[model samples]
Every structure is written in structure tokens, then in C-alpha cells.
Target: MEPRLTNPAGLLPDVGQAVNILYKSAHTAGVPGSVLELVHLRASQINGCGPCVDHGARAMRKAGETDDRLFAVAVWRETPYFTEPERAALALAEYATRLADRPDAVPDAIWDEAAKHFSEKELAAIVLWIATTNFFNRLNVTTRQQAPANY
Candidate 1:
């Protein structure tokens, strides 16, 4: 689909810069880059944001994630590719991203599991990553943004 307009980040440089700052901070929030990309891809899949799924998967590959493991991110519970910590982060990402679908938003069980694997700072980063991805997902989906062919 043709996008309604150019990417807002390009159209509005100041707002784009602010988002870039948040994006950069999330990357340094101590979560592994691979785990963060997995979280990003899953959330984009849930949100049906094609651009994000494309970009996130490419980013994961660039970080040396195997295709087998990246492809299995959606079915993480049934896969043996992820470590406990990665699984915990994915669980948290799904729960947080689907907040409107469930009464609890993030159930205590999921939070407890993630807490087991991540320090408070890391947890904050994970949450921020999820939130940031969701923000971009909405923007892209709403604007009918398409993934670049090379992305």
C-alpha cells in the first residue's frame, strides 16, 4: 500500500529526533540486542505492522541471530531456541503489547518471571522497548507505511 504521507520522522524532524533519543536509550537499557529485536518483531507481528517486522527481523539478522531462532519467536513457548531469560522477556512483551485484550494488562506471573531474569533497570528498558515499538507500530499501521524492499 502507498503510505498516506512520508514517514513522520522525516516530515517532522524535531519529533523524529525526540523519538530517536528514546530509541537510542532503549537500545542501551542493558537488554541484549537480540532479545530486544525479538521483542520488537513479536510486538510488530501482533500489531500487524509490516514495516516494523521487516526492520526488526533485519536488525536481528545483522546482530547474528539465526534464522531458525528468529522465525521461532512467534511460537517461543513451543520452541527450544530461547533461553529462560529470553522467554521471560518475550512473555512480558506479548502481555504488555496486548494490554487492551486482557484485564490484567501484564499479569503478575509474567512480571514475576521477567523480574527473575532482569534487574529493575533492565526491566525498565524492556518495557520501554515494548512501548517504543508499539508507538511506531501504530504510526506505521495508521499511515499505511510499507516496508522498504531492502528492509
Candidate 2:
């Protein structure tokens, strides 16, 4: 899609501040950068947000995530590449992103499974991570931000 408005400077600063807070909180809450990236990629995939899918995947790779696991993330249920914690996180991300489909919030069973790998604080971070990515996805999609093929 063609670029609509090139001057985002006026609006982005405030949004950037919120993003900064989210990042700091996520790190402080004990969510690993890698796990955050995985959740980002998964949520982006579900939303079909190209920029996030591309950026998240690349960030994960740069952080030393395996290509095999990255490629299998969409089909994670069938793949043995992800650890149990990662799998649980991915499942949680999916539910969070597709919340309208469930409307009841994430189930306690899924929460319990994810909690096996995360402390309460970490779980809070995961929720924020998902929420932030969803916001990012909507923004990028609304702007029609395209992901570079190799990004």
C-alpha cells in the first residue's frame, strides 16, 4: 500500500513513551526478551501484521533463536522444537490476540499451564506483551505498513 501520512512525528512520541514503559515493565517482570519476541511473532502472525511478523522474527533470530523453531512456530503444536514454556507462552499469546473469539478472557487451565513456567509477575508481563503487540499490530495495519521481504 502507498504511504498515507509521512509525518507521524506529532503522534508517535506519546505512543513511543507508552511502548518504553511496556518494555521496561516486561523486562522487570521477568519475561525474557526471547519469550517476548516469540509471543510477538505469534500474535503478529495471527493478526497478519506484516511489519510485526517480520520485525519480531528478525529480532528473535538476532537474539540467537533457532531457524527451525522459528519456521515451526505457526505449527508449534506439531513441533518439538519449542520448549514447554515457550509452547505454553505461544498458546497464551494466541488466546490473547483472538480474545473476541472466546470473549471470556483466557481460561484458567491455560493460565495454569502458562504459570508453570512463569511467576505471577512474569505472567503479568506476558499479558502486557500480548496487549502491546496487539496494539502495535493494529497501528501498523491501519497505516498499511509493509514489511520488507527480507526484514
Candidate 3:
């Protein structure tokens, strides 16, 4: 479908400010670029947000991520292609973003596993990464923002 509005430029205020916050959050948490991309892609896959999935997947590849890892991300639990840290991040992503389906909160096992590969700051960043990606997924899906033709 075509866009509901050409830009919706007047709809929101401080759009630049919001983007700045997300950009700072991404860097401050020291979440690796590759890790952040994977988290975004995985969350977007679950949310079925085409823009996020396309953007994240393209970013991952641009950052030199292997096709095997990208392709297997959705089925990561059943594959041996991911490294220990990536696996932990994926698990944490699922647990955090799927909170509606898991009221008990992220389990200790998942945290422990992730903690093994991340510092406290890194873990905090990871959580923020997941949260931020979720926000973008919702925004894109609700707005029906189409993925870019080349994305």
C-alpha cells in the first residue's frame, strides 16, 4: 500500500531529539554494532515489522556479518552457527521483548548465561537495545512504513 501521508512531518515534534536519544543509547551502552543489528533483526522478525527487519539485516551484512548467521537467526536455538555471546544476546532479546507471553520476567538462567559474556554495563545496554528495537518495530508496523526498496 502507498503511504497514508507523504512524510507526516507535522505529526510529531522533536523527532530529531528522539532520534538523538536512540543514537546515544546505542553508543553509550557499548552494544557492538553487529550485536545491536542482530537484536534488531530478531525482534523485528518476531514482530513482523518489515522495515526493521530489512534495515537491521542490511546493516548486519554491511557490517560483515555472515549470511549463515543472519539466515539462521530465527532458528538460532536449533542451530550451532551462533557464538556463545550472540546466542546469549538472542535469548535475552526473546525473553525481554516477549514479555507479554512470559509474565514471569526474564529467567535467571538466561541472565546468567548472558552475564557470562557481558559486563554489567553491556548487559544494561543489551536490555536497552532490545527495548529500543521493540519501540522502532511498533512504530514502523503501526505506521505501515514500508521497507526501502534496496533495504
User: Among these predicted structures, which one has the highest lDDT?
Assistant: 1
Q: How many residue pairs clash in each candidate?
A: 0, 0, 0
In the order shown, what is each candidate's alpha-carbon RMSD? 1.2, 1.9, 2.1
- lDDT by residue for model 3 over 118-140, one digit each (tens)? 89988888888789888877777
- The TM-score obtained by model 1 is 0.95
Model 2 lDDT per residue over 38-123, tens place? 99899999999887898888888888989998998899999889889999999999999999897576888888899999999999
Question: Which scores higher on lDDT, 1 or 3?
Answer: 1
Whole-model Cα lDDT per candidate?
A: 0.90, 0.86, 0.82
Worst 10 residues of 2 by lDDT: 3-12
Best model number under TM-score? 1
Per-prediction TM-score to the true structure, in the order listed: 0.95, 0.91, 0.88
Cα-lDDT of candidate 3: 0.82
> What TM-score does prediction 3 earn?
0.88
lDDT score at residue 25, model 2, on the 0-100 scale: 91
